[model samples]
Target: MTFKSINPANGEVIASFEEDADYALKIRLGEKSFDRWKNTGIEERIKLILNLAVILEARKAELAKEISLEMGKTLKSATAEIEKCAITAKYYCQIAEEQLGSIEVSNYAHKAYYKYEPQGGILAVMPWNFPYWQALRFAIPTILAGNVVLLKHAPNVFMSATTLEKLFIEAGFENGIFQNLLVGIDKIESIVADRFIKGVTLTGSNLAGSSLASLAGKYLKKSVLELGGSDPFVVLADANIESAATFAVKSRFQNAGQTCIAAKRWIVVDEVYEEFLNKVSEKINKLKAGDPFNTESDFGPVARLDLAEKIEGQINFLVKKGAKKLINGVRKGCLLTPTLLNMSRDLSHSFTEELFGPVACIITAKNTDEAIEIANETNFGLGASLWSQNLEEGEHLLQKLNAGSVYLNSMVKSDASMPFGGINQSGYGRELGVYGFYEFCNVKSYIIEK
Candidate 1:
């Protein structure tokens, strides 16, 4: 099978490449390179990562263009994404030594410490929606910890994948230290079963996570999954309605609402529901949806036509089930206007489903307690943003929300300094921070007694 890198905005094929026919050879090369890479000094590894960061910074313009052309994100957003990758590389480079350093477990009598060791190759199944950021967030730390990487990126973003592989080599990494396998989903199981592949980490849908996780379990390999999300954006009566409304639009509409961390559901307390709705509706109307290459456009089209169709189908299904379309969204091929739907409280099933496009579902909550209840009524616990003027009360309410990360008076985001992942169907394990750096490491304990 051939993977075509098509521009989602205009449906033009930018490039195409045949699937990697010699996948076995690629895996073998990864196996050979693991020993050499793992044995390299941490200082040298950090130096190479810094070099990679420099290259990412220097070539960000061309790289961002490829990303925007392939994935339909605005050039500004794509440029920011590439810059974030570079910043994260530098972040890990600064902290890798301490994060990966050995820990002393015993202070008296006998010497005992816990040391982190790389466990060969890790297979990363990355998604296309923030293609560069998604792949590097996992790869940078995993590689810095001395493990080799085999990337199986989403087919639609194969061009970005190949470019990433080239960047690694340009930074002076050995051929197999980081390899991009162009094979499809069918080959994932075989790759996971390979002795050279020690673990698996995937950032995609729940269905994809389940299949690959089962394979990892069968092969006795450790796995980390960052899956889908229906994260809620809660607004209280006393909260800064204007600021909350502004950030809400930014969070829900950015990336054309394709992000896993994007706020999919909006739960506003009845006390300020009308005010919040009016502000958001007005803000949504002003959004400019146009060519991704245009600097003035606030957002671009959805990554593909099928994705737009799916969003449209989901909106239609909800409208049939008694959901009110407060602000109608117009769809043209891959471009979709920002939409707002006022959802009834009884629509429990739709609340659980993940909606991936630029449509925000608004649910009115009677009060703060009810708002919390509505926000927690989903299978996804990825992330949530709560707005309330009462900092103490909001801090206390944080314990009640069942999410991986909750933000007060701010939008939900994944930071290099924080652990990012979710609970329940949102998938387990984490990415970023110290926990992510140690996910694929062997935490071996060393002890000696005289």
Candidate 2:
């Protein structure tokens, strides 16, 4: 069977490609490349990684267009995503030497140090959201650390998967240093268990994370899982309501509300609830849902038709549980207008479950205590956004909020300069930054004799 990539905007077929059935061959290739690459000088790797940034910029338009068509991301957002990926790749190159270098430690015998050694080939099972960014950020760091990469990108973005492979090749990397295999999900378990694959990192749903985590555990291989996030955007009464509402609208609706760390729930203090709601609702109404490639489009289609169905289904569940829609939802195929909802908090799936599309829910809290409570209520402990003019209050609340990363008076976004990941069901392990650059490396200690 052919793997088809359909454009969500107009329901057109972007392209169709054959899935790579030669998993063993690719695994062998990755293993061989890792053996040779692990001994390759860090300076060379850094140079190649920096070259990727140059190439990404040169082909920004093409890459962004592919992402926009494959995943229904607005052209503007898609371009921004590519730029962010390029920046991340280069940043990782800048810090790889220091981050992956050996560190000295005191030992009684003589001298001791921590050695960061590459184990072998690493597998990256990435999601379609942020198609290029998510995959590149993972692969670049792993490969730079001297381990080869086997990317098992989401099948929906097969074209993107191949493009990324070509990207690394064009950057003067040797064959198999970074390879993208167009394979089905069913093959991932054995690939993770393969003796050649040293570790696995996945960025996808909780269900997928669980399956891959189990396989990695069963085989005693290291695994990093970055799963779903139903993050809360907390707005306090003392906050700048106008700025809070504006950011809320941006955080929730950007990318058609498909981001893992996007503010899914808006928790507001009662004193400013009405004002915040009115402010955000008006902006939500102004969102333009149209062709993704169009410059004027603000909201594009959710990746696929089924995703839109899931969004609609969740909204229906919430409305049945006494929740009310603040704005009438306009949905056509994969295109959905920004939806503002007043959550009833009735034990409904919509209240607790994650809505992965252009849907935003509002929950009012009487005070800061209630706001904190509502923020921590979700099963997902990913990134969160806190809106408050009082820096001291937001700083103190940081320790109280149950999330991996919390932004103060700003939107939560992944940066190569900082560690990005989540806690609880949002999954374990971190990615990006110095902390993540060494996730798949062997942090070993050895003492020298005098």
Candidate 3:
């Protein structure tokens, strides 16, 4: 079957491509290629990885445009995403030797050390949001460490998937070092079961992660999942109200409010709750939602009309359950304006669900204890941001949060220097930093008697 990537900003067909008709043959080629690639030295891999940053910079404008057209994100944000991916590629190159090289485990008991060996092939299931950025987190580190990859990107961003494949090819990757497959999700189960695919990494919703992870588990293959999140932005009484409110707007509304790490729930202490609400409402009112290609637009489409519909349904459900809208806004096509809601603390849908759009739901807490209680009440434990003037107290309270990462006074974001992942239903395994690159490696131990 053929697929066409439709521009959400204007509903225009950007490009059409046929799906991989012979995935079996593709997997065979990938497996065979991995056999050869696995033996390559780390020095050669680093050289090729370093070249990616140069290539990405040369074509940054064109690539950023492609991203905006396909996924309907603001041009500025799209460019930032691509630039971050480029930076991450360079970072992996810099630490590859030290991170993946052999390490002495025991020097006296014979000669003993630990070596990182590559698994044959991996299947990457990625989402449309931050398409290039999400995929590169796994692709650069995995491919640079000497493993072949088959990317199963979201159908809506197939243009991005193919574009990235071209980038790797231009950057001197081997034929099967990195390839994009346009097949449907149903194909993933069978692909994972294939002897060639040694592991799987996915960045998507909780439902998608669960189904795919279970299938991979059945096959006894390693799996790393970066799933959904209901991240909290907590505002305490002692916080700098103006600064906290500004960052709250940024953390919640950036990327049109379609981020897993975006602050979806605002749990504020009662002491300054009203003042914080007024600040956020004013900022939300000033946001301009328009065409993604427009440089000055504050918000853009949410990737797909169906996804927009899903978000509206979520909002309506919460509204019926006593969640009242403060600054009501409507949705047009895939573009949703900034919406603010005063969420009920009665265990309603707003607190119990993941709002994956521009709908900001606020809940007032009696004190700091209640704020944290509300923050940790979700099934997702991805990330959380705490706001407080007492930085040391914020640090101590941060431990009470049950997420993979916690920021004392900033938005939770993925960085090449820090390990990023979540526990509980948000999924397992980590990405980024030295810990991220080693997720797919076979840490083999070797010892020789003297």
Provide the overall lDDT of each model, using Cα atoms, as 2-decimal numbers: 0.93, 0.87, 0.88
Question: What are the runs in model 1 whose C-alpha is more than 4 Å off?
Answer: 107-109, 348-350
Clash number for each model:
0, 0, 0
Question: RMSD in angstroms, all models?
Answer: 1.0, 1.2, 1.2
For 1-450, candidate 2 gives per-residue lDDT tens digits of 578899998889989988787878989987878778999999999999989999999999999999998989988998898899888887888788888888998758588898888899889999998889898888888888888999899888999989999999899998789998888888888888789888999999989999999999999999998999988899998899899988888888989999999988889999999999889988888889889888899968999999899999988888787778888787899999888888754442235577898889898888999888888887889998998888997899988998999999998998888889999989989898886678999988888896
Model 3 root-mean-square deviation: 1.2
- Candidates 1 and 3 compared: the better one by TM-score is 1
Best by TM-score: 1
Better of 1 and 2 by TM-score: 1
Where in model 3 is the C-alpha error above 4 Å? 348-351
Q: In terms of lDDT, which candidate is stronger, 1 or 2?
A: 1
| Residue-pair clashes, model 2 | 0
| TM-scores, all models, native as reference | 0.99, 0.98, 0.98
